[model samples]
Target chain A: MIEQSINKEPIIATDNNGIVIDIRGLYKSFGAHNDVLKGVNITVNKGENLVVLGKSGSGKSVTIKCVVGLVAADKGEIKVFGTDITELDDKQLNAIRIRIGFLFQNAALYDSMTVRQNLAFPLKRHSKSLSPKQEEDAIKEALDNVGLAEAIDKMPAELSGGMRKRIGLARTLILKPEIILYDEPTTGLDTITSREISELILAIQKKNKTSSIIITHDMACAKLTADRIVILKDGIIEAEGSYEELEKSDNDWVRSFFI
Target chain B: MVISLKNIFNDAGNVTQFTARFFKEVLKPPYEIKEFIRQCYVIGYRSLPLVGITGFIMGLVLTLQSRPTLAEFGAESWLPGMVALSLIREIAPVITALICAGKISSGIGAELGSMKVTEQIDAMEVSAIDPYKYLVITRILATTLMVPLLVVFADGVGVLGGYAGININSDVNLLNYFSKVLESLDFIDIIPATIKTFFFGFFIGMIGCYKGYTAASGTESVGKAANSAVVAASLTIFVIDMLAVQLTDIFF
Candidate 1:
């Protein structure tokens, strides 16, 4: 394991290679009541599952988006693998981005492509020397991991809601990304499907040994997949603990999420 | 609401800036040759049937409609020369562009707008893919190159229709009718018309792409983008054509 440091004096501690992501005082806003993210801070250790819990508009999604440099912050630092992503140029950002996978709230599958072709996009793009056989194997492996190998030939338009989400996960996983950012992965799913998806997230963590930051309002999803849950409120992390610890908290509002 | 001059100028500035950015990005590395070819096939070759049928009808109808007037003056022999010159010089290119402005522009706009709202474009970006090079540049270039080719196709079919129209009521042979049509058109009539079609294609594609690529998020916004694209592209076609004619008049 790589050595890391936690600076006790400052709010954020980023001088650590072991920390896959270290965000310091991150801030963003879109004319909401307050800044979307005001002086936010977070850290994801190597091979860890960090769940960001918040209400519908509490900027949980925006927080993870900043980690991938998808949503630009008004102020603060976002370091992915010890590299400050906010300062990187387009080419440099793309270089760092390949290592990070983001699953949107709606899946965001390409309407024009089949599942096979959709998975093939990132595979064909980043790795120029991949053979047809190797690509096929990777596609199959990714789909199998997500347990949707049968949906390979189907178009996104033809897939059910859960199936679309699984295919979307397959597309992201095919790249074998080191860090996955899942935004509301189980929002629209049924109770059973949501639990299944949650298990898939856990399976991915153990099998692939990838770090993840999952943002969700689904407490069930948080309980299943989280190693540590951070409650985001008023653009900052209000509470951070294990599921059992945060659930029994004294703060009525923070405890409100549990009930 | 009343139209403000400031809004008009700002709109022009934004479009101009968008067009300039497109030129810069289109020339950059990582050229999407395969996708560009695919777009060319979809935007150009696919549009031929519509333009062809429209061209033929326009020529045949013009010939039939103008016959009575020519008969009154006893100058019916001038029909072939008049229609040929008009079609080649202006009618075919403008009409074909208008057709494409309705079809291709709306398609590009709606496709991109939907992508925007659904976050497919955002997905491409997060996946480390160059969505601008892959989607915007290819579609715009396809439009820029395809519309001119479609106009040429329209011109040929329109003149042929004129020849057939003359044959329908009279004993004019196909060979003689074609020869007379050819005799009336020179490089001057063809060159400026063809040159302007390139501009038509460029603006139609550029406007459509700009509208869609910059579309605000919503399903309703997608339809609006498509409708706006048609209106904007068609209006620009006439603007470009008017400038083309004035310049041609000064030069030729």
Candidate 2:
């Protein structure tokens, strides 16, 4: 609900709260004809919760995909933690990826692996110093953090929608990423569960001091979770501000959601 | 005609992107070495029985069918060498590759395609896990290692089946038949044919993983990826085999 004047200029970079991600003039298209993302620019500060609100197929997902190098951009520079991700080779990108965590929309838990194994996966990959006992203790701590300590032995299929989300969060936290991305975290959950997840997301950001970019169509989620919201439409930024600033905008599309 | 041409061009473009992404991600580190071995077990070791049985039956049936033809030439003893050469140089590797294309390729395609449809892959990306290195490299490595082993086993069993046929139906001595078969076979025929299987495995693994990994939106796309994996892998195996034969003939 904090009001701040909107400006197109890049925010001044300071070392106190370092700029974690800087995306400049990003462009992506599936082919010669179908463009999914036009030139887009954004920056995320350390420990900030930035929500991306857009209609389905508005390139919100595509934008984040480019950030992680999941979907390569046709042009532009993406800098993460002062390193230019666009110029990074695969090895450098992977090194950056290990420091970032992502919570998939559908939880994306490996069906073949149990919750314990799922949590162990990233830890095993990213952590070399942890002994088997320490890995087990860490898994227990992560699962407990998400309040799913009891579901450690269970498969993803056995869990409810909300529980699966918790497991996904646990898997993401296992890596202790400096940045976390959430893609429609609450889209399919009921009202109560959705709010619970939002609170859980806030708790993680506070405790871990991790920056986040959440892509969702749920304005309620954007309002409750984001310090700043960026609304995308037709592959371009339509509006960018704090929740209260967007609510007060004269733009019909921005006002429609509020009214 | 124009519409069809346009469609082909569009498909080609998509394939190129998929290929580019695959190559880009594969060379990256944090390589899924353990997952790669597990997948090799699934795609290669688990698939061995089926490939072996099929090769055995193929050798048996082919030997039986060729007996009468060779009998007419009064050269029935040549049956052992002919069957042995064909099974080692052609049938075992091609058939094993095809079976793998059907089984491993389709399975990978369907599994990944469904993951895409359900947004699981997106979740991994958000979590900062490189799903490509985690998923594609493991599978491609599995196919690359396992296919050659499958081909080797299939070729050995197939020759035994041919020996079984000659021993049962004719007066050909089991020892003499095997000796003739072994004498006719050299490392050159076996090595080159087996070598081609690595490429076959690579193609099947790459095409299958590519189709599934880049599957379009929705549940139907999952089905399309699975189907396309099989079709693309089968076509690639045949094309590679033809090219290999032409090269081998010219060189040797």
Chain B of candidate 2 achieves a TM-score of 0.93
For all predicted structures, in order, the TM-scores are 0.94, 0.82
Each prediction's DockQ against the real complex: 0.83, 0.42
Q: Tell me the spans in candidate 1 whose CA falls farther than 4 Å from its real position.
A: A1-17, A31-34, B1-10
Which runs of model 2 end up more than 4 angstroms from their true locations?
A: A1-46, A69-96, A228-230, A233-253, B1-31, B116-134, B166-177
Worst 10 residues of 2 chain A by lDDT: A1-10
- Isolated chain B TM-score per model: 0.96, 0.93
Could you tell me which 10 consecutive residues in candidate 1 chain A have the lowest summed lDDT?
Answer: A1-10
Deviation (Å) of B108 in candidate 2: 3.0
**On residues B161-185, what C-alpha lDDT tens digit does candidate 2 reach at each position?**
8977776776766788789998888
